[model samples]
Target: MENIVIIGNGIAGVSAARHIRKLSDKRIIIISAETDYFFSRTALMYVYMGHMKFEHIQPYENWFWEKNRIDLVRGYVTQVNHTEKKLLVDNSRTVAYDKLIIATGSKPNKFGWPGQDLHGVQGLYSKQDLDLLEVHAPNKEVCKRAVIVGGGLIGIELAEMLRSRDIPVTFLVREKSFWDGVLPQGESQMINEHILEHHIDLKLETNLVEIIADENGRAKAVTTDKGETIACNLVGLTAGVSPNIDFLKDSGIALGRGVKVNRFLETNIEDIYAIGDCAEQHEAIGSRRPIEAVWYTGRMMGETVAQTICGNKLEYKPGHWFNSAKFLDIEYQTYGWVFTARSKKESEAHFHWRHPQEKVCVTIAYHNETRQFLGINTFGIRMRHEIFDRWLTESRSVDHVMEFLKDANFDPEFYENYEKDIISKFNSDMGTTLAVKNKSWKRIFKTA
Candidate 1:
């Protein structure tokens, strides 16, 4: 039997293992220092907010692994001796394999601010980080205040997590407006208002100068770029994350911002592959980034690589960019390409719509000349992925999309239908008399 070893049993590694098992009977061993079993990484915040338990994040029962003939090892991988096809785990134990897969994910980025290594200063990424959060900020009394650095999605999430426990939070954003680089002016402004409404002290155009450490080496406060100090017990470093590929430094594997991989996710060495957040595409795939940190893309890469290992070689092709996230009470979804002013093409234009009082809005991007629909960003609304995906593939026009807007709505019955309002706004902007049409259930449900 061929011994297949996979390091870092995240969604990518487990996905490849599961698919590979279905295709061939190979000895599969998944090693990770994080946990004994695979768990949902996205649900870590929910676990902290009392919505779920640590064990509940795990999707599979303990018996499932044994039944599937997949072996799990609990140890930190210290080194990868690729020449010998062996891994140094815990700096002592050695494991050998015929084929190896590296699915190690990402680690939070810290830029060496003073007192960043203090007890109360940390980043939320792994289960260990979640555990640390519980110790540092269990409640309002324990952690009086938390100062979050960076203006990205992770920063917002940390603010929400701290607020759930009645802990006051002061958010420090270097950007003039929160996520302005990615979002439009309207959406970013709306988010700024929504955040303030939640009672978070959002400080824009502010930078963390230093984190003041207490006598116990815990973070007590942080000084800003303007030389203003704010007292806080916890400091969350939500700057960003980079690929976790430190162990492979001496392994002769080519490295960019992440592990360099070809279309098939193969690394520089033979019989070795890398996937998930740690794998960087040799070339950009369409509008997608080389190293994607998103969960769905990681899952897709795993399934694609599994085929090659099982004698059915397949290329990793993640079509049509789509993602969903929650910004406090509002749910946001985006499909296809929605570029900001910096990245937008000269021929591209956008039509935006928002409710008078509610936090409901949508931005549609299209070709200015051709009127072909390019992408859309919807907030406080549910949309059908299949509908938009099919429209993109068909190269449907913006006018056509507006006429059939109701079909794209996921919950036309329960959710407040905004089709008429959206159509009216679009017509007002485009100067075209387009009427809203009833949803075609057949068209919405049809699969390619």
Candidate 2:
């Protein structure tokens, strides 16, 4: 029996292990210092907001691992000896393996600011971070105020978590607008206003200079780049994250911004592979980044890598970009290529429509010359992912997509349809009266 060792218990590692077990009878061992079992990392915010407990985030029951014959080790990996095919654990134990998988995922980025190592100063990434938050900011009385240092998704999530407990939050975003670098101007402005409406002290164009520490080495306040000092009990450093591959520094594995791997997720060394956020491709895949920290991509990578380990080599090809996120209470989803103001290099045209009374809007991007559909970003509305994905794959024209926009909607039957309004706005903007066409259910459901 071949012993397969995986270095992380995240979704990538667990997915690989499960798929490998189904294909082969190999013995698998997953090791992690973060937690004993795999749990949903994205659900950490919900846990803090009292929506669900820690155990609820775990998809599998405790007995599932034992029944599947997968071994779980709760220890830190200090080093990996590629030549000997062994891992050195913190307890000085040596674990030998025939094949090794590195899916260590990401860690919070720190820029070596002054007093950033204080007790109350932390980043929200791991379960340990949540535990520390529970200790530092148990309630509104305990945590008088929290100053967040970044304007990214994690920063806003931490702000929402703090707000759920009636704790005051001061958000410091270096960007002039909230996430403008990634979102369109209209959407970014709307989100900025929405965040402000939530009573958060959103300080735009601000940067953190240093974290002030009290006598006991706890964070007391934060100093900004403008020389303004804001007193606070906790400081959140949600700047960003980097691949967690420090243990592989001396392990003879090639690394770029992350562990360098081919499309097959294979490392330079034979019998060793990497997946998830820790795996960096030689080039970007379509519009997807080289290092995608998204959960579904990680899961897909795991499934792809498992086939190769089981004797059926497969390449990782994640087609058609799709992602969903929430800004405060509003739900946002985007499929295909919706470029930001900074990244809009091509000759494209945008048609944007928003509800007069609600925070709902949709922006469609398409090539100006060819009229080929590029992407769509919808907020406060539900759209079928498979429909847009198929349309993008087929290279549907903007006019064709708009003519049948009502078919892609995933809202309830009683919910109002905005297809007519969206079509009207598009026609009014483009100076073309393209009437909506009715199609049978078979035609609408047909694959492109």
Candidate 3:
């Protein structure tokens, strides 16, 4: 049996290990820098907001490792010696491997604004960062202000969490809209309205020149480029993250946008593969650039890399990239390509479904030309989560969806046929069930 070594024990690393176990009874070892139990980092915001307990974030029980017969090493990886096929650990120990996988992910990027190293300035990237924020959490009654410096999903989520604690949150973004790089203008404005209504202040088209610190090194205020200063006791930076590839740089492994891998996710070096946030994936759409690092994308790449190493020739082709985020009691989702250029001339159909009782709105986006569905964004509704998933996986045209929408009700046979068509196209499963006792689902439509 070959010895397979994987660095980083996050979601991507653990997902790869699970798949590789099914393929081979090999000696698989996972090297994790964090010594704690495997927990969902994405859900930490919920924990911070008191929506869920910290224990609820654990992804697996302690016996999971024993059941899987996997070895876990708690240490930071310092370097990868490609020639020797060994990984250098922080404590100077080296472990050899027949195959190596780098799923180390990325780190928070603080773009060198002055006084960034101040005591109260924080970034929410890992569990450690969450702990740091918890430690520096301001006294609600004494200091009620917090300035969050980013408008991305993570930044916005942090803003909501801060608001839940009754601390007034000010979101300062250099971009003119929320998630401007990913979301369209209309979608951004819709979510922005909901956020503002929830008592959060948004300062768009703004730049943070420097973080002003108090005598004790705590962040006291932020100076803006537009000749303004906002007084806040705490500052949270969510600028962005970059691929963590410092150790692999001189290892002769290819690096373009990230660790360059083919469709099989194999690195330039033999028996070496990269996945998760660190890997530069092949874009199934127009450009082959590294796509945004979403959890599902990382999971897909992890499984694909494992299969390839197990001698399976399966290729990974992502149909569409999607990310879902919720803020101030409203849920928002986005998928596929948000039109960037007018010359692209892509047609999109949108529909807003509102529930007056719940005061919620569900927006759907469809590609008009291909008649194929693209994405959906539902706010203040939970039942429509599956609707968004169907839209993303089915790859249906707008006309097909519009036709189904006209009927509104789907028959049993039609639902099965729709599910079959969707599974065939996306090569993934989206299970749907009917509420009636012993009754089957009549139809499942993909809405974009």
lDDT of 3: 0.72
- Better by TM-score, candidate 3 or 2: 2
Task: List, residue by residue over 156-208, the lDDT tens digit for candidate 2.
Answer: 99999999999999999999999988889999889999999999999999999
Candidate 1 per-residue C-alpha lDDT over 228-294 given as tens digits, one digit per residue, 9 for 90 to 100: 9999999999988999998989899899999999999999999999999999999778878898899
Clashes of each: 0, 0, 10
Best by TM-score: 1
Tens-digit lDDT string for candidate 3 (1-448): 7999999887888888989998889888999886555678789898888889988888888888879978898888888888889888985899999999888888877888999999888888788888887767745764568899988877888887888788888889888777756555555666677778888889889888999988998899999988998988889998887888887778899897678877777888988888888888653434334645778878887788788888887788765555666765676555554443232244765544444344345455666556566655445433333443465566766444433432332233434324333323322221232122222223453222
Model 1, residue 392: displacement in angstroms? 0.9
Report the poorest 10 consecutive residues by lDDT, candidate 3.
429-438
TM agreement with the true structure for every prediction: 0.98, 0.97, 0.83
